[model samples]
Target: MTKTDLRHRDVAEAAASQPMLQQVERWSAINSGSANLAGLATMAGLLADAFSALPGELALLDGAPSERVSASGQVLETLHGRHLRLRVRPDASRRMLFTGHMDTVYPADHSFQSISPIMDGRLNGPGVADMKGGLAVLLAALSAIERSGAAGSIGYDVLINSDEEVGSPSSAALLADLAPTKIAALTYEPALPDGTLAGARGGSGNFSILVRGRSAHAGRNPADGRNAVVAAADLTLRLAGVASPGLSVNPAKIDGGGPNNVVPDTAVLRVNFRPAGEEDVRHARTAVEAAAASVARDHDVAVEVHGGFGRPPKPVDPAAEKLFALVRECGRMIDLDVRWRSTGGVCDGNNIAACGVPVVDTMGVRGGAIHSPDEYLIVESLAERAMLSALAICRIADGGLA
Candidate 1:
């Protein structure tokens, strides 16, 4: 009846009829955990084919070799990973980045790879919510934009990184390179169950502390041995408090030490942290390094804390605030109520934003149970998200309200 009404009708027509759900199901069924290098390669190939088939400019960046060198000089050259980039329209000065990861937390051995049939209108799978569903939604929304004949109005670049689950060790450079040139970015990492978006995200870092201590006979000279496990335990306790104003420190895993007999000579502490700002991240790192050194000195052990902030914080800058406000307005235009919240949960978006691009991190459809068998996407939001993203793309490329 009216312009707004007609627009809504157009959005509905554009989104309601795609094989997008099938795409989601297929992707979710393939466990692409970064640890499963083989599976990730397969998924990357699949994504390449999908992108190649799209009626747009697409490029499959050559795989890069990322090596993990052990203390023993053993070099573990990880699988050569591929990243896909697809561009719609062209405006180099006013660019946008749409980021998502093709990798999930499920490994090749995980039993959560099955995509159950529609139950209560929800499809369940390993990555249905975590992100495979989001990828499908990306494709569907792009297709809808294509059909809307507004494709040329939205100049966007879609980047699907293959190694997000493992801290994105290899793809960070690409994200950085793309971020500096983009005006805004939308990361399809699913919204909350209530359909609220992720406002600002904390920066993330992964660290591992290896302690080396002298081992001695348990019964004969237990006192003569320096216990690396003890040093690690102390360090962990201290590292637990690294969370300050905008930082959170978490010692997730610790390993080493055989039986209770001989004094333990080795310990490995694996910890992860997230910061809300650059200073927060630096403070957390300082605290971690200080704690490690103190513990090692006190326990007569050699300790090493090696790692850096992998993804910098996507602070609540004016640009990001503008993005959220725009998306909210976009929701209003589509008759959907949308909200957002800041969180410590990091994603590829954080990595993207670190490159200085403003980004709305939760552009995916509302969903829950990410990384679990119970994962599901809210089917009702499929069209809502697609329309919102497409509309936003159009506005941004049109040089307004991005």
Candidate 2:
């Protein structure tokens, strides 16, 4: 076993000796969806209270950034809330930001709100992997960093946003604001079942295309009516892999239709594109616009596409690679052969990377099936990650790990 490996293991053990699991269970009990106004407020309050209990500078990021919340298949409502960004110390230069989202895919009234024991080693719960457990790890890791005589070494910041599950529409600006000054960032997103994590992510854009057309009787005067669904279908077919350059075009839903007797006057096509690179994003956006224009022109209907790229892809930056190497070295120092990889899943890391900050995601506890009721976090990796975080912070803080 390497020295860094042994040190990481010891630090992990030390962190585990604290009330880590208890804290995880505590946070896991809450359902904080981005759109759940009351729940989000409660969670923000809980986090503020928890951080206040600790010895750091804690405050609500009221001015950080926020937005109106919207749900799937529903009109948007005006709801204002912000992510919590805290800095333990302000004097150090080489800094790191640790980010986690309090939001989950599950709604406030979902039936699977209750956590259940699935097996000997797994506890299935909403947001357990998609990341309430990861938040627990973040808090615990920061706590250990403070307690392990390494507090304030690297001038770290922790940003816990409330809207990562819905593509981080509201929190992206806040993340970018916090990113420019930091040397690196560590995001608390759950690792895969085997503890692998994102090395590359596709930039995602969610679009709603609304088509306006004239309605008429289908059987009696089909030619007089414009079938918006048909037009939308045409648009969908055309948009599917239009550029095919590391971009995926997926048409998820068709809305605003009528019964069998009448031609649909309006159609809304929910289209989302994931681009493998930033250039792919630009190309995809142009293609979507062209496809929308072509459809509108051919069908003599007006179409509007709403929404843009929320977060860009976190390509394997050299700094990110360095941070990952440091984590791997820390793992070796602790005697654990860490398993990790890159992926196309988007997270708060995307927002951080958009800020031009180097980052290593999957710094949260190891887990699987995030954003699902079958979500589970590993019982062991909590401490491992905490330890790795501590060492990374210490090494980076103490003069370039030399």
Best by lDDT: 1
Across residues 71-163, which tens digit of lDDT does each residue of candidate 1 receive?
A: 432336776467788876666457678888888887778777688778786777777877876787777767776666655544667889888
| True-vs-predicted CA distance for residue 8, candidate 1, Å | 9.0
Q: TM-score for every candidate vs. truth?
A: 0.90, 0.90
* Candidate 2 residue 42 C-alpha distance from true site, Å: 1.8
> Which residue window of length 10 is worst by lDDT in model 2?
66-75
lDDT of 2 at 368: 83
Task: Write model 2 residue lDDT over 1-402, tens digit each, in one string.
Answer: 657445545555665566666666777788787678678878888888776645667777652343321322233544546678787667776667888888888888887686775466776777777777777777776676566665555687778888788877776777777789888888888877676767877788888887878889989998998888899889988888574768888888877776999898788888888888888988988898899999999998888777788868878877777877877776676665666666767887887887777788787777887766677877777776676666666667655433
Q: Model 2 reaches what TM-score against the true structure?
A: 0.90
Off by over 4 Å in 1: 1-12, 55-57, 62-77, 88-91, 147-149
